[model samples]
Target: MELQLQIKMNPKLYLRDPEQSPLGRNIIQHSILMIQKIGFEDFTFKKLAVEVGTTEASIYRYFENKHKLLTYVIAWFWTWLEYQLLYHTNNVKSPKEKIQVVIRLLAFQLPDQFTFSHIDRNRLYEIAITEGSKSYLTKHVTQDNKDHFFKPYKDLCARIAEIFREYNPSYKYPRSLSSTLLEMAHYQFFFKKNLPGLTDFANAKDDAGVVQFLQHLVFSALKKGS
Candidate 1:
C-alpha cells in the first residue's frame, strides 16, 4: 500500500520539532508504543527513555512533559484523519453519497499501511479510540487551546460539518452533528468492547454492525430536515 501523508501541527506543542531529527522522530515513534503498552497515566519519560535508549532529559527536550506529548500525537491523528476524509470524498459527486462515505470513514477500522515509516498508525488509532479523551480533558486544556493545540481537531469537525451543510443547506446543527458523529464512532466502539451494555452492538467484534448503526443514526437525523 502506497500512502503519502503529511501533517503540519502547531509548533508550540513541542519544545523542539520532532520532524527535525532522527532522534526526535524516534522519541515520537517509541512514545506511541509505550503509551499503548502502558496506558498514558502509567507512562513516564523515564520508561520511554529506557525504551528508546535515551535519557529522560533528551525526551523532555522534544516535549515539555508527557501530556504535551500526548496532545501532539493525538493532534497528528486528527489531522491525518481529516486528510483521509478529504481524499475519499473528493471524487464523490452526490451529497448523500459523500455523507455516507464520511460515516464509513468515521466508523471503519484503521488500515495497516506504512504511510509514515516512523509512526505506527494502527497503534495510534487504538490509542485514540481508548485514551483520546484524556488528551483534552484536563485542567490545562484552556491553556493548550490558547496555544492553538486543538486546531486540527476543530478543523476536522468543521470539514465534516461542511459536508452536512451540503447535504442539507438549512441544517442548523451541522457542527454539533458532525462532532457527535466523530465521538459516537469512538465511544460506541469503546463501549462495545469494554462496557457492552452501553452500546447496542451485541458482538464486540461486529465492526460492520457498528457502521450500520452509525449510518442509521446519521441519515435518520439528516433526513428529518428534508
Candidate 2:
C-alpha cells in the first residue's frame, strides 16, 4: 500500500518534530505498524520492542501501557482529522458547501486514515461498535468524562453548529442541524459501513453516492420549512 511504502521509505514523515529524539516517536510508529500487522488483542510490548529495536522499558517511557498507546493513537487520528477539516474548509463561504466538502474529505481520506491490516481492521471495528457503546454509557451515566477520541469531531461539530446558527438564527435547536449532520455523516461511515451487519444500510460504498446522500439528507432536514 502507498501508506506502507511511505512509512517504510521515510519513517520521519510521520514525525512532527525533527529535533525531538526519534526514539519515542519511532517506537510509537512501529507499535502502530505492529497493531496493523497483528490484531491489537495479540499485540504486546515485548513483541513491539523486538520488532522496533527497543526494550520494553524504553517503550514504557513513552507509554505506560498498550491501552495508553491505543488512546494516544486514537487521539492522534482525531487531531489529524481536525487538521484536514480546517485545511479543506478554509475560505468556504456557504455552510452547505462546507458540509459537502467535509463529507467528501472524510470519504476520500478513509482508506488512508485507517490503514490497518484487514484482520486488525475487523477486530478494531468490533471494538468500536461494542466497546464504544459501553464507553458511551459509562461516560454519560457515571463519570461524565468525555472521551478524547472525539475531540476533533466535537470541534468540527461545534464549527458546523456555529455556521448553522449564523445562517438560521431564529431556528430553535440546542445545536445546529449542521452539527447533527456531521455526526450522522460519521455514523454512516463508522457504523453503517464498518458495522453493516448491525445496521440496515447495505451496499453503501464510500463514494459520491454516500456524499450526495448525506448532502441531500442534511439540506432537506435543514430546509426553510421542514
Q: Which candidate is the best by lDDT?
A: 1
**Candidate 2 backbone collisions, by pair:** none
Consecutive 10-residue window with the lowest summed lDDT within model 2? 5-14
TM-score attained by model 2: 0.64
Error of 1 at 114 (Å): 7.3
lDDT of 2 by residue, 25-133 (tens): 5765666667655756788989998987978787776665665565455434444455556666778888767767666764553334434231233333333332333
Off by over 4 Å in 2: 1-19, 109-150, 171-183, 190-206
Q: What is candidate 1's CA lDDT for residue 127?
A: 90
lDDT string, candidate 1, 1-226, tens digits: 7677667879899989998899998999998998988899999999999989999999998999999899999999998888888778879889888887887777654442327888988789879988888988999888888889989989999999898888888878889999898899999888988899998885655588888898888788788556
- Which candidate number maximizes TM-score? 1
- Candidate 2 steric clashes: 0
lDDT of 1: 0.86
